[model samples]
Target: MTPVPTAPLVRWYRTSLAGHPDGLNFRRLWVGDTFSQFGTQVGLIVLPLLAVSVLGADEFEMGLLATFETLAFLVIGLPAGAWVDRMRKREVLVVADLVRGLALLTLPAAWLLETLTFPLVLVVAAVVGVATVFFDVAYQSYLPSLVPSERISEGNAKLQVSQSVAQIAGPGLGGVLVRALGAPLVVLLDALSYFASVLFLLRIRHREGPIRRSGRRLHSEIGEGLAFVFREPLLRRIVATTALGNLAGSVTNSMLVLYAIRDLGIGETGLGLALSVGAVGGLAGALLAEPLLKRVGEGRTIALALLPALPMYVLVPLAEGHPGQAAVTMIATSMAITGVGVVVYNVAQVSFRQRLCPRPLLGRMNASVRFVVWGTMPVGAFLGGVIGSRFGVLTALWVGVAGQALAVLPVLLSPLVRMRDLPRGLDQHA
Candidate 1:
């Protein structure tokens, strides 16, 4: 077999930095995303705390909140994609961010007024969830326009790194803020983050062209996006792998808090610390991803990253000693897996999609893929709850590990493993 040519490390580094000539615009975007992500981190802590403290929610409610939040991706994803295609992606992102901020703000407002209720919290979650769907789809679509095709992986790696940083800092800070300021007040910080994002977006003066919607109806446009994803070989494989992986991951996620609180006997502070430690791995993964991809090629890099992470899932349940030791082990294993796994998978997948997709269809393609990939979370969460209730947490953890391991099957069976770089140009058949 002929050896596939790979981009040299020096060339890849140069390309990653100067790939987008509008360095200022890229910097602004990065800063904006980072700032808003900090707020998002706060909300992640506050929202759950609100459920537990103010609303007095049970495990079932927590599961339900996750279900509703993720279900928005299924309900709004395709249509939001079509809608985003018709408008400026940056504007869509700004509007979505603002809306989410408003929704989050309402939670604190209601609490202050002594009017907070479980139903009201549910409503807030759903609204925020819907807005997030729009923001995420638009945000993904906007990246290709912001940077060159050759540099897509690097750009995505940088963005993922920012998110990982926020994940590390946000949760720990949020835990502290929640303890000091109370959960309701902590939401105000996320609200401020959205405003910060809006200001940064307003400063960006670049003009993004609208998608060529022509005379297509909304449903027809959505269908076209779905067809486009399903018809492509590389996309089809990616969608299958990600969908399976996300579903399996969701099973563990639903029970994560329960396991930490009950099995490990860890408090909120300990949980935050553990998750923060894992973020270090994510940071390292993002920083190292480009070099790794250049050396190994995108396809093999993805395969290698995806396969080894499954073993880490088992480590969480194995932490059976003192709470401190268990927390540390979980954090270390999680950081290693998440940091590398997420960065590698995202860089490869996003780049592959950007290379293949037409600019006009970017939003639709993103939404369609996310719809399928994220749609499974609710079902997995529900199933996890059922299994946890029936078979217990240990058995559920085993199921999660097994399911994550099986995610490799799609990559192994597909042409992705044998391929190195993404195919150049658009092959209609591909």
Candidate 2:
């Protein structure tokens, strides 16, 4: 037989294996990430519920609790990125998970001792927030090291699917458990999930590169990351879009449980069921993202995905005076639609940034983007609380939805709208 072009076949083989589970350390990462996401999803519900239902926290205090959970991203966000770069990302992931698990354990312990207080909840939230900052930066930075550049999108899709699945099940599970076992005891499950994540993480065998130290001042290192993000027009725009979105989303989220339980008279089961139903949209988004990106182009996908959800948010505040079942349905519908946009936007934007940055700057770049985007969360949460407390929860929802409507403007006006595909290999523009 004639030579079958060995070189081409070898190249094709490598390409075929790029995103497959067995080809890299992604399988273990995926498993660990799933557990972590499940824990986080459950915590998202129970933590706030623990404060509101158990400790009798009002709207402003609820906002404060939300602020504490995200406060670390604002305070240590920039420095955490620089720090992650100088350390083994895997180690950082492991340590972050460990810290979160331990801190979460304190909640159940406090509860068992009958010493559970809002302040204790706040402290634990703050600790978990700090660990989460490190974990997020490390996890994003670590993915590029684990998979080939071309397969980052695939890896992200799979990870997002896992997160989506967790979202789908977690709230309902948390509700049932909280109702059955009490919210305090339910926290223990979230803690256990984090521990499970650690075990899965330890099983990964992918060796990361030795830590690279610049021996430079911390501020300077941070500045480099900031500079990279700001210097790129597209990245800067994406940051603005996401920051605004987070601000709006946090405002709404901070008030959502309070509004649902108090204003709408949604029982725990109804609230959880609504949130769980909404997560189905996230799963759909994750599954559809790749194909949508291929069809619409990555940049356009980011821009387009956000628009459909703008009006969807209006359905939320508008549900205020409806019957309980109708209100819950409206809330679930809004969540499901918004969840789809959020997931699709995230998968596209995150993959684009990962592909755009050099490997060394991955940690800093991810951190910088998150710093800008997530930093807005606490501020928004605080504003939500203040607004909800002063005006009314329904008014706060209206204000939040209005902000969500405007958040799309940044990306819509950018060159992303005109482009068919996001550029690759360090090129910031199409």
Candidate 3:
């Protein structure tokens, strides 16, 4: 097949805005997501600052927080999938947003009352974490029903761009908020963002189809999803590669802020600025991903994206003393690679799964795959802290680089890297 011509990804954004009949609803949803993303970015920055600045948390406490937040995915992902499959996904999404908003509100309230404690932070984090898992699962399943298959990549690209823009702006805004209003108060803004998201979702007039439910027991239904993922050749390879990559990514992510403060001798504001700059690369990468995928093929494109991180990961630890310049370079390069890789990988993986998995099984299949792939995150986060404390932050970074670099081996060995085209059906071997 002749390679599809590359076009500027911004064109996809323009088309997404103008092409759909429910253009207003789509715009509302996108705007809502952008606002929610902005708020979430605030929490991501402020929460850690709270631990380090107010609670005097060490590496272990930070790691524990990370672990607690993600642990629910291991326990609840499968069942959540089963439950969501039987309900209106939009309703689930709305409710999840509200729940998260309420949970975040507690932090600011407690702070105002002078009752905020480390335990309170932990509880709130866990609650938000649970809500996040539900929202993510439903959101992924809900998108296919909203847009056509050929447009899925484009639609997702728009969302990714929104997120990248938030990442670029949010942390800096968060840092200022934390500095001016305090960490706890910063969370209130996030809460309000979620509320805004709920309002936007309510305005969406596009009705979704009835939810698919299996009369089988929950456990049995969960098993069916798992069976589909493991039995499919393409899914199996993607899962393996993703699980390994996540393990590495989580390790690095868990320590990045802490490393920046202690090892790199950077303050919170400087760290935020660096991260914000890096998100620019992420924005560029997300914009370019579809064109890259079309030209190189999904498998080869993914493999090439994976290789860029090897050098970038190594540079992260070496970025000491020269905090501003080193951080800007490190974050920008890292985000660029991650943004592109995630967009391309998700487009191929999601489209493949949707095309092959029976519509009835879509929810469960997503949940099962998530349980296996995302379940490793908490483990990686915990291990990262333990390793960082014992071996030093720089050494821990090296380990992360090694693990992430080696993760590409699975894709390299699988038919995923060599296959010229995505399989037409679940049963077709790659």
Candidate 3 structure quality by residue, lDDT tens digits, 31-53? 77777788777778888888777
Off by over 4 Å in 1: 1-21, 425-430
Per-residue lDDT tens digits of candidate 1, residues 1-430? Answer: 9866666765654555434356556667777888877877767666776676567665566667667767788788889899888888888889888898898888788888999888887788888888888888888888877766666676788887888898888877876777778878888887889889888977767777644656868999899889989998877878888898888877877777666655676655666667777777778778888888888888876666777676677787677565676666665676567667766777777777877888777788899998999988887777777777778766666787788888878776787777788764463232
Instruction: Report lDDT per candidate.
Output: 0.77, 0.90, 0.76
Tell me which residue pairs clash in candidate 3.
none
Choose 1 or 2, whichever is better by lDDT.
2
TM-score of 2: 0.94
**Index of the highest-TM-score prediction:** 2
Model 2, residue 167: distance off in Å is 0.7
Evaluate residue 250 in candidate 1 and report its C-alpha lDDT on the 0 to 100 scale: 78
**Angstrom error at residue 405, model 1:** 1.2
lDDT of 2: 0.90
Candidate 3, TM-score vs. the true structure? 0.91
The per-prediction tally of clashing pairs is 2, 0, 0
| Best model number under lDDT | 2
Model 2: clashing residue pairs?
A: none
